[model samples]
Target: MVTLRLIAMAALSFLAASGAHATEVKCKGNEAMLTRYLGMFDEVFNGRKLDRIAEYTSEDFQPHDSAPGTPKGHEAIRLLVTNMAKSFPKRKLTNDLIICGGDMVVAYQTVEGINDGPLFGGIPATGKSFNFNWIDICRFKYGKVVERWGAGDALGMMTQMGFKLTPPSAEAK
Candidate 1:
């Protein structure tokens, strides 16, 4: 028992010296932060209210996983939502789970839609329907999202939309 206690003490001391700490995952539901997070989907995505982008995002917003060449700040989100809306006019975004910890909120969501309009401003509509799952980690400051990280099944959605992927030729390799 004495040896076990000494070992535990030593481990604790080592962790303290290494600055190791537990992450707090306290969910803060019904708060303004969570409210705004959900509201972004409702008002911006579902409602197609691009003007309200500033209402939900900070001026210096940064979406770490935005498409290559997408400008930072609220414009990135605007461009994203606009393209998605054009590609999937009747899309519905639903949050399956939302977790809030401190100033960060994580959302697991799904988007269901039919490709009834032009995609990426040019690709013809496939008239195909698809459902894709995605996740987002948003950091809020002053009731606005200042930073975001997200990933989704773009390849899966494309496959569902009848898009084919071709392998490179041996000569190219």
Candidate 2:
């Protein structure tokens, strides 16, 4: 637990220091793209329209915080949405804040759901409920997202799912 807390704290500090300073250019129409992005999330996560995800992402999409071996290219993102639905079938994302600057859009959101299926590279279902917040920064070009960075509350999810972050010395390296 101590380790997880430390990592989350470091990430929070980094985000606070390096956020919202990426550009000085004005984005006049990016708000509409952001709206479409949120709607894409709703459709993929709730409406089960997994086939339409390609409409919102670029051909050379990049994932900044994706799990290892999570594939690459546009299909990787589609796979992620698919896995999210499989793991948290009742997932809900509530957007708290959204800011668009130039071609970038940053959003703060909370995700609440039950983990009743596969997750984290074959971790078995725990059937436990959890609510955690995350931040997603997406960079767009010509209406499609070119890159995205997601910072998720993994510690909260693990604890809620009845897992422990034991000391390294007390366990294996």
Candidate 3:
């Protein structure tokens, strides 16, 4: 009876191990999905192709920034991009670093542009140019980007555009 019990336990252990291995294999991240997401960033920023957002983002896509509200869905993202482009007509984004792990990608980039257009973030453009860095963390599920979190130096950009929080001290006459 003891020998029979040992054999049955070993068989069960083998089955469990095989099941775990199968699940791990199935849950692996798809490289093609990662590549597509990276490419989408290029198209959106460099090519200014806002329409391509729908192709890479999920129907329920959500983007979170340091700002209070979140932008949801492809249409919202498109509108956000359009407004940003209008605010900085000569804006350029350069990817400084891109790292992908599992199903998440983190991108570090720098944006350079002239603030020569209408005001953004309550700060009017002063026709001044500035460069700012930002970091974005994006997650993909089932080959589509489902979520993103972005943060950058909004105050610094405003400062560069000559918007000072405190009134400048009058120069000594």
Q: How many residue pairs clash in each candidate?
A: 0, 1, 0
Candidate 2: where are CA atoms >4 Å away? 1-29
- The whole-model lDDT of each prediction reads 0.79, 0.74, 0.71
Instruction: Output the worst ten-in-a-row residue range by lDDT, candidate 1.
Output: 16-25
What is the TM-score of each predicted model, taking all chains together? 0.78, 0.76, 0.72
Worst 10 residues of 2 by lDDT: 18-27
Q: Highest lDDT: which candidate?
A: 1
Ranking by TM-score: 1, 2, 3
- Candidate 1 collision pairs: none
1-173 per-residue lDDT for model 1 (tens digits): 75675466456445533545343333656377888987887888679898999999999999898668889988898888888777788876666677888889988776666789998749999987666788889999999999999898989889878788777784477
Regarding TM-score, does 1 or 2 come out ahead?
1
User: What is the model-wide C-alpha lDDT for candidate 3?
Assistant: 0.71
> What is candidate 2's lDDT per residue for 22-62, written digit by digit as tens?
32322356758767667766775457686777877877888
Which scores higher on lDDT, 1 or 2?
A: 1
Query: lDDT tens digits, residues 1-173, model 3?
Result: 75675466456445543544221112235557557766887787566698788877899998787355645788667876788887888776766666678888777776767777787556566887666778878898877789888888878777766666754465332
